[model samples]
Target: MSSELLPPNWPAMSIAEANAALAAPGSPVQVEDTVIDGVPSKGYTNAPPNIHSILFLAAMTHPERDYIVYKDERVTYKAMLRAVEHFAATLRDKYGITKGDRVAVIMRNYPQWPVAFYAALSLGAIATPMNSWWTGEELEYGLSFAGVKAAVVDPQIFERIHEHLGDLPDLKHVIIAREPGDEHNHPSVSSMEDAIGPANSWADLADIGMPDVEIGPDDDATIMYTSGTTGKPKGALATHRAVIANMFNSLTCTARMYLRKGEAVPEPDPNVTRATLMSIPFFHATGSFAILIPTALRGDKIVTMYKWDASEALPIIERERITSIGGVPAIAWQVLEHPDRDKYDLSSIEVVSYGGAPSAPELVSTIKRRLPNAAPGNGWGMTETCATVTLNIGEDYVNRPTSAGAPPSAVELKICDPDGKEMPAGEVGELWCKSPSNCKLYWNRPDATAETFRNGWVVTGDLARLDEEGFLFLVDRAKDMLIRGGENIYSIEVESALYDHPAVMDAAVVGIPHKVLGEEVGAVVQLKPGMSVTEDELRAHVANQLAAFKVPVEIHFMDQPLPRNANGKILKKELREQFTPRG
Candidate 1:
């Protein structure tokens, strides 16, 4: 190759190869379709499209690059792609995870999580990721709701499975990652490693060659459970086109804002290895569709964490030279406040993307101050939108820090009044989104499906406003709005102000019924470690900042942490349930 023809740091691969490095794995080339019982199944009528597209592209372009790192274990792109294929083959030939079959995965962030997830997806089986932190009751609800016939569970959660076993009568198999203490005594559970290892370490399946199984662009790819804020959690079905389209949109936005930002960003070289630290849970759409899929599609390295521990994450970021991070506000805050934070060389971090919940201004400012090399990007979406509907990118972020940015290329956004009439810019209303990434319907919940999805727009249950510049700002959950003495108060507004207090570690505001006022504001706050402040002082602090109606009439201090879901979202419903006086 002529020197002039290639840029100084250009990769060995040609531009076509570099471009292919980012392509999705098309339908599987040669794979057989297996049968699944009891599901109103859609046979593999389409070629192995999405998973095949991603795996093939990554293997061909960035074959030897690191794909995942879990503790001491590391797998390269070539090896990882093979593992996915091999496991997928095993599922088809050995197990019966066929098209449209519900295969659930219950594990924290680990190498096996993605392996099981994509393996199921490759077979045209609908992968369902349940929160690892879910109780037995919650797990039973999800298991039965998704019609989950089989599940890959971490051994740690074994007891929870046993608790719900009688209820999950349809469950045919339980694939455990670790070995059982005594095989005969362990019931129906079997070791996944033993089941798949004899076939070879999942890498051989990529090349073993099997008959082709067809899949469609619109076939179900994954089913993510809702936060269950309203009542019981419902599964939201995401098709291949929807998931892939979400990845494509995220890739485009990140390529411009995140991957291209710093001197350490390496000028988009196909050869310069990129790695990411996984902080988000595998069950959420933010983790699977947003972070993992995009990184895998790019053939970037992923370092897994069993759970987000700031002390452990900082070392990993410096050790891995992690280029990008995507997580909730809590993880970002934890990392920033880690004891040995300054010891780690976090200069390698370029983009610190955050979502899950609206970031506290203090946390946002803290990240910007501490990690000058990293910029905080916020996203807004739900399980229905496949993670990101609106993204705050580049200069728009500084101009409007509170805004969640504009809708991504793949999504359309609008704020509408209670009657579904479009609201003017800067006017608060229900935030609605329309996109291919939007779920087809709420699984088995026809009434919810109708209520949430109307005329192609998914009602997010979020109250928000779009600015003149098209930036979306979330106010709070519509259900969380407090109507006190004929005055409307958004809890988020009050909570954000409370967070500004140095003594405040966490804060949640809700409405309590009042005999005279109809309802009064009640604030629940947790103080920073070793910090102490009186309720009068806290109330005065807020009163000085916000309107009187928005100020808390009562304050409750807690020594314990706020109750949160797996994604780090405060479970206001639980708090309400706990605080409300029972007869």
Candidate 2:
């Protein structure tokens, strides 16, 4: 959509003009040409040299401010820094963890997670955050794959990986957070309380100070594993620069939002506290790079949850005055449609954003209708890109509901055909992105790295198109697109149509085997509570928006939300099994 068609006072300046002003020299988010891993790319000139620098700045700037809020516990930046320093000292002095050693952080979204992560990075050790939801065998594979020397895990994760610890001989130390009184007689296992004390008492611990280690911008800082749906998960090795680039890109996006509104960007106001409800797990890039690091740098409070529950989140928002709420679309949907949402004082919310899945356009309008103070935001990113490649929010999202917002000046986006040839705008093809935030390589998988990372661009498997204004419209994953009798069908289109139905809460479209056609369109839908819809009614609703062939031949009603992976993407493979023929 063009700016001329946008709502009045929305996008007062063109996207190009906003980007030009933001990237000009002397700007806080100035963009510059640079080389990354032998390939030319654009990078932020003012971004922190590394993640530890951001942590140091945060601690020095906001010592007594609340940094992390879990259930009944609140940790200040001073306490967090103390814990990080003490843990770093323990890792170095006790376990002999040094630069270049891989230290795995396998835990849920707790205060200890960030402590473990920052401590390892501060010591120049590669911080590998494994999925806490993974099974014992999967955890074993991740630990061995990275050759981790030490691991910090929650009590539940400890039990999950306890049986596999003997299998991973390279793992020399294990620290369990909030361990129960039961004694597990393991040689390598230890308690986190012994290292840094409890979460609240961290500030009183003897602070040995940050580890004296040299960490360069291009040095490997993280090894984040991808959500393995098709095959074994590949670990994307990211540099310190790659992860920190996200912080600047987010700042640029925020500046652009102000410039596009014909308003000057405001300076930071320390008196007004900004808080975000962290519903997503820190294991994902969207959680770690996008939310965790950025919020810390700005001294924003992060109210975390053990898991996402709208009932639990609403009261926290009311209590903490959360300024932002985000995760997957399902998270925002539950909050907006919650039966008791009106019972709370949720006037502080300003942004309700989500990504990592296809969202219904209706969700945008719903947010506008229900929460007048909040603006609905969406973006497109992947594990390979770190996060925040393109952000669509506020009026821009309302104007082009389907298109993901354009990239910042520091990133390049393109559409390519199957043969790696660039495609023209409005053409459906694989979306490729090039930026300083792109991961260096897939750990221990040279062939996979060669296939995915072409030059500096990460060949994202998502099938998308660029509009004339550079807005991205995602069609579907390249592998998820189905062919029925030689006609291509994008599953997202059908899923979007299903979501258009008022009663539908979550929906997934998958291909079911057919004797005649190569594959038939099939759908699994979960309706909102107290809502009812027949399979025929849903088919008719979709038929009104899509072709007959695209309509689902079989529709399965689910009592619960559609199954998703750790990254909040719908598990179409598991849903496909529902259509399996009974022998």
Candidate 3:
């Protein structure tokens, strides 16, 4: 810890410096150009051997640090590691769960969720995190899709999926958490507390260490299911290499900021733990990649809310001294606009950021206004690219309010025309991104995988333009683009304009059927509480900012919030389905 050993001006290393260091020989995250699983892309020469290697490395460093926090219940890294060991051992010894076996973890944001996830991973099994918000039918599809061998669920989730349990042939084990005394007559069902008996308890298991499963970086790890807006949700299978690469990317970026601010990469302190409010469900990549994985690397405490409630979140932030808030754009909107915001002591918040949904430029400024000390950040990526490959923060973010910021050095983003030719800077076209953080494949759908994962690039559905400096401004999802007669309209362009209006709270623009024009612009808006506005007035508001064709041919208002999936992304397809276009 000598002063001269660190960066000259700052005790912390800059991202540029860190990047240089990473590229050097013997660096744990050092980079090299090579083909990974037939995809020519950037990859780590020193990527962690497996998921357990990464988790265990963290636990060994900060064993006593707080890992999970819910209400007054706190679980330390040591405790979590022990549980993971016990669960992994029990699954392997008692249940015959082994490598490549799929274990579905269906539950709310509880401490046991992570334990189950890591336990399965520790045994070289694929951890399938099914959407907690899914219905019985959806749950059945997921279990059947992954061929789930076992599932660690809670009582409430069991009730939702129990009806369809008979349909899943491969499901052999069910360890239900939170329902202590209840027992199931089903052969597979057992309470979580009863399963982790004294014979294979955490105390006994911690001494035995990880199982003898040798997992390589390219080995199967997570089968994260997509939102399935169009059809059945596709499971994006991420490798250990892909997941760990993302973790380093986040560290490099944050370290870059810390150095810029003349701060050091603080040593892991058990008492002085960094806290984040976990509002996003873990099923989403944003929750897993951007929040959960990165926080674990830093040994930071994650405080989970059973469900998203801005009121509940506010107190947790104040009491836990939560340093950052993120997940979805709606969470930020709700927090900054909450009527009872003044009642809580929310000064501890230092960062506010979100993605996975459309964001108005105004949401950024609103966050800065409410949390004066907090820096507002926004970025774009999808389930395919492991959440965030491009991230914009600080002055770069404030200056270019509309852009999804620039990609990290390890990631590449490009705009291409309809024919797949590269577009010049600032020209709008399909956005394609390539990175090691990109998932390996779409679980079992080879044809879909071939179509999307071409030549190491994720053929993102987003239509975007990149400035000369590489700031990406997302225009719309290519499929969502509307055509009115000969005129083309980007729904996001129109939605952003509507968001500029004072009364507009949440808005979505879609293309409705039109006999002559093929399709016409349509808007569904949820106004601020008690606010009223004419449809024509709102149309005029958009017309002022966009071309005439982009103005909504139809405007529908709603008394409630728009429909959203587990990730807080508005269900545009559902919105489009709600209306029958007139001739």
Report the number of the highest-lDDT candidate: 2
- How far does residue 432 in candidate 1 sit from its true spot (Å)? 1.2
lDDT of 1 by residue, 1-583 (tens): 1234223443343322322332323421111233222212112222325755676687789877777788877777677667677667767776677899999999878777887897788788999999999888889889898899778888776678776787787787788765542462645567677645521254544375422667767788888998776678888988886677666545444443432232122345676777789887879888888877777676788888877777788889988999887677656766776668888899998788888766666765666678887777887878898887667755446546677866533356789998999999989999988765677888898998999978667898899998774668899998888887788899889988888887886788877777777767888887765578999999999999999888987788877767778876888766665455311
**Top model by TM-score, which number?**
2
Candidate 3's TM-score reads 0.91
| Tens-place lDDT digits, model 3, residues 478-500 | 88888888787888888889988
Q: Where is the poorest 10-residue window by lDDT in model 2?
A: 1-10
In the order shown, the candidates' Cα RMSDs to the true structure are 8.2, 1.8, 4.9
Model 3 scores worst on lDDT over the 10 consecutive residues at: 197-206
Give candidate 3's whole-model lDDT. 0.79
Give the per-residue lDDT digits (tens) of candidate 2, residues 1-583: 3455356767698998999999999999999998899987898888887897787788889988899999888899989999999989989999999998999998889999999999999999999999988999999999999999999999899889989988999999998888841377788988888888889898787656788888888999999999998899999999999998977877887788888878899999988789999988899999999999999889889999998889999999999999999788888889888899999998999999998888898888888778889988999888998888888876678788887798899988999998999999999999999988899899999999999998999999999999987889999998999899899999999999999999988889999987778899999998887889999999999999999999998999998778998789888899999996421
Measured against the true structure, the TM-scores of the candidates, in listed sequence, are 0.85, 0.97, 0.91
Note the clash tally of each candidate. 18, 0, 0
lDDT of each: 0.73, 0.89, 0.79
Q: Can you give the lDDT of residue 93 in candidate 3? A: 87
Give the Cα-based TM-score of candidate 2 against the true structure.
Answer: 0.97
